[model samples]
Structures are given as structure tokens and as C-alpha cells.
Target: MDINKIHYAEITISAVSPKQYPDDGLPEVALAGRSNVGKSSFINAMVNRKKLARTSGKPGKTRTLNYFNIENELFFVDVPGYGYAKVSNAEQEKWGEMMNVYFSSRDELSLSILLVDLRHHPTELDVQMYDFLKYYNLPVLVVATKADKIKKSKRNKHINQVIQTLELATEDKVMVFSAETREGRDEVWNEILASTRNDSI
Candidate 1:
């Protein structure tokens, strides 16, 4: 697939606030992951643009639902990364509530990309996120990021661990990607495109 035609069309922050999102026809793919797990970098890499989703070394920088229209066909929703931060307990609870609402009731959401760190196995937060997505019966594409950080021989073991942890059924659902190196960008894009087109809703 030629990805050169892909481009960012628009972006909206705090889209679910004020009222609710309009019933846009465009299929939406939600991105979810633990804080500082390179969620932004994955988006930027998939879109073939730098700084599109605002890469941050610090955790919990993105506190809102960010919507980015891609190639005018699909909307890439960057949901706030969960786990770890200096925020108050109440604030964290608020974030959790907001995320739950979005995940449970978003009509336009077609699929979710659950990003995980390839350097390590799935963390507790990651497992919770997996179960949460599964709980909603939402389709998820697991992206194992930072693949280059680990040795090739050890990569499969870690990936298998993630699959077992998430109780994934299909091996093809796991995507190994390196945002910094632009590796596996096309494969990830293919998965997104496939998910977007599959619209079971």
C-alpha cells in the first residue's frame, strides 16, 4: 500500500467535552497505552509525520481525547495514556471515569490500538487496559513498540508473553513496531486500514 497519500486533515482536543462528539461518518481508531510508552511516537510514525501527536518524555502530558482525521477516511483518536503520574488521586479517578465513558459509549469508534512496550512484558496497567477494551467488546490491535530496543531472539519471547498475558487468540493480531526507526509502519497502517474498513457496526 502506498502511504505517501496519507496526510493529517484536522485535529480536535477535548472533543468529548462541552457536549458529545457529533456522529461523524468517519470510522475512528482509538489509541490507548500506558504513560510514556511512546503512544505519540507510534501515531507520528504511522502518519509519517513528526510531532503530529506531541511526543513527550514526561508521563500524563495528554489529558484529553485528541482526534486527528487521517486521509479524510478515518479518524485517529489519541486517548490519554494511563498509569503513573504526579496527579492527585481524585484527578486520576476523574480521568478513569472519563475514559470509561468514552470507551463504553463512543459510537464512531471502530477499533482500538493497544500500544505496549516491547522491551518489557505487559505491565499491570497494560493488562487492565486489555481487559477493559475486551470488556467493551471493542476490537483491538496490539502494537508492540520499541522493538529495536530488544534483541531479535528475545523479541518473540516478549511478544509471546504479551499475547499470553492479553489472552490473544490470533498470532497475526500482534504487530511489532519501532516508531523511532520507522519499522513496521506499513504493517501497522495495513492493520488500521483493515480495521477501519471492517466496521462491524
Candidate 2:
């Protein structure tokens, strides 16, 4: 569906618990990233909507799994961003507990999309998250955002650092993205489409 236009998408629900999630049994794509990783921007770009997902200057804005229905084809679940030190220990634990339960048990989760900053190597927390998803045997697609901020000549260097830091296998998927230029946007949609196909199979 790369060439086809994706015309419908809307926020179906903001779920704090599994019971609150949509029961339609659609294949879901779960997005995991840091607070400022431009996830909201990424989602809006993918759906071609300006503000389908809210953007905030403040970090750690998402506290629940925000589910978006994409043309009734699949669900995009945006999970809370991690590693914001300004948040209290109590809040972090709550976030942790919430995430643990959601990731550990969600079966409708067809793919996990991990966002890392393209400008820097993956952080310790990012590595842990990647491994955590791997532990669950979930297929992950690592997306490096803010590609336009860096020089083209240095792009491979940044990408390789992410690979080595995460110990990603050569076969593992990685995609560089730029919200400014919308570069790699169509390819991401194609990858999402493939994940949905795999879920159906």
C-alpha cells in the first residue's frame, strides 16, 4: 500500500489498562521511545495528520497507551516515553508497572517500533528496552529520528553506532527518518504494512 493513500486515522482510546484497550482484535503496532524522541510528530507524519497525536514541549507527556485506528486496518499503540529524570521515583515505578503488564501480556501486538535519536548512540535505557522486546519475542523495527539534523556524510556513522550499541543483528531492520523533510516516510508505511501482513499470516 506504499503508493496507495492512507486516508483514515483517529485516536480510538487512551488506555491505562488492558481492559480499556480496543477489543476489535486488530493487529497493533506499539511505539516505544524517549519523551523527546519526536514520537508524536512521527505518528502525525505517518497518518498525514497535523495533530492526530498531541505534541508537547514537556517530556514524559504520555502516561497511557494511546491507540490509533488506521483505516480500520490496524492499530498504532503509542506507549509512554522513558528516561526522563525530572519525574519522581514513584511516578517512574508506576510507569514501569504499567508498561510491564502491558508488554508482557498484549497478544494483539503485532510489532514493536523503537525510536532512538539518529544524532547519538542508543542509550543504556534504549538498549534495555530493545532487549526487553526481544525477550518477549516481539519483532522490532528500530527507527532513528532527526536524520535531517545531521550531515549526510556522517549519517552512516550514526546509524552504525546505533547498530553496535544495541548489538542489532545484521538482518535486523533500521530506518532513518526526518520529520522536516518527510524522508523515509513512505518506506515506514510499507514496513508497517508488511508487519500487518505478517500478523495476518
Candidate 3:
């Protein structure tokens, strides 16, 4: 895919309710991660846009499911981040319900890109999200973000740790990503293309 040829991309909707989801029938690739896991940076890097997904220093800033249309081919659905301690239990429950409804019921969802911090082991919430995707039989591609923060010599070790911690299957794909360096962008795009192709079949 030509990242340079991506001419049309924008947040079509910030959905608080499933009723507000776009009905265009385009395949959707969802971004799932804990708060401050660098999902926004990933999106911006993937699309070759600056500040398109709204990066923030604060965690849990994305409270809605943001749908971004990319060249009319597919939608990158940035789901709200999980595991922020500042949010109240009641708010977390609401977020959970919103995510559950979307993940389980949305037919357009082609794949869920699960992001985790590359420097540390996968969090309990990360594991839970991975499990939730598997429970629904959703295709997932694990992306270990912030790869630039870790040394190249230790990258493989960390990646292996993530695989082990997540208990990823042999066939499951994991990409080492760095938004700053754009290291894994091509691989991630290829996975997205393959997932969408399978979804269409």
C-alpha cells in the first residue's frame, strides 16, 4: 500500500453509542490497548498524518470509539483505552459495555490490533483484552509499541516475552512497532490488508 497515496483520511465519527456507528459497510480494523499505550502515535504514523488521531500525554483521553476513514478502503476504529486508574469504576463499566457491544456485535470489525508497551510485560488488562478478542473469535494482530525506546539487542527478548506473556498462538502475528521511527508500519499495513481480504471472503 502506498502511504503517500493515502489522500482521504479523517475521523468520520466519535461514537459514544453503537447507534452512531457509520453504515458505509467498509471493513473496520480496531485499535485496542491500555491508556497511554501509544495507539494515537501508531495511527498517526500508519496514516502518515500528524496529530490526526490526537496524541495526548494524559492517559484515557479517548473516551469514544473514533472511526477514521482511509481512502474509502477501510476504517481504523480507535477504541477507547482501558486500565486507567483515574477513571471511576462506574465510568469503566460504561466503557466496558460500549466496547463489548462494539466488539461482539459489529459485523464490520475485520480485526483488532492489540497494542502493548514493548518495554514491559503485558498487563492484566492487556491479557483480558486479548482473551476477550479470542472469546469472540475475532482476528487479532498484537503490536508491541514504543520499540524505539528499547535497545535493538534487547528487542527480540522483549518481543518474545510479550509473546509468552500473551500466550499468543503459533499462527498469531506480532509486530515490533515504533511510531517515531516508523519501523513496523509496512508489516502492520500488510497484516491489515491480509485481514481485510480474509474478512471479505
Residue-pair clashes per candidate, as listed? 0, 0, 0
Deviation from native of the Cα of residue 139 in model 1, angstroms: 0.6
Question: TM-score, each model?
Answer: 0.91, 0.94, 0.95
Candidate 2 local Cα displacement, residue 140, angstroms: 0.5
Model 2 Cα lDDT, one tens digit per residue, 91-197? 88888888888889998887899999999889999999999888888889999999999999999999999999999956569999987889888778778878787
Which parts of model 2 are misplaced by more than 4 Å? 1-4, 198-201
Report the Cα lDDT for residue 182, model 2. Answer: 90
Off by over 4 Å in 3: 198-201
Question: In candidate 3, what are the lDDT values of residues 1-201, reduced to their tens digit?
Answer: 466568888998999887899998999999999998999999999989997888888898988999999989999999989988999899999989999999989999988999999999999999999999989999899999999999999998999999999999776888999999999888888889888864221
Candidate 1 backbone collisions, by pair: none
Q: What is the lDDT of candidate 2?
A: 0.88
The lDDT ranking, best first, is 3, 2, 1
Error of 1 at 39 (Å): 0.8
Who wins the lDDT comparison?
3
The candidate, 1 or 2, that scores higher on lDDT is 2
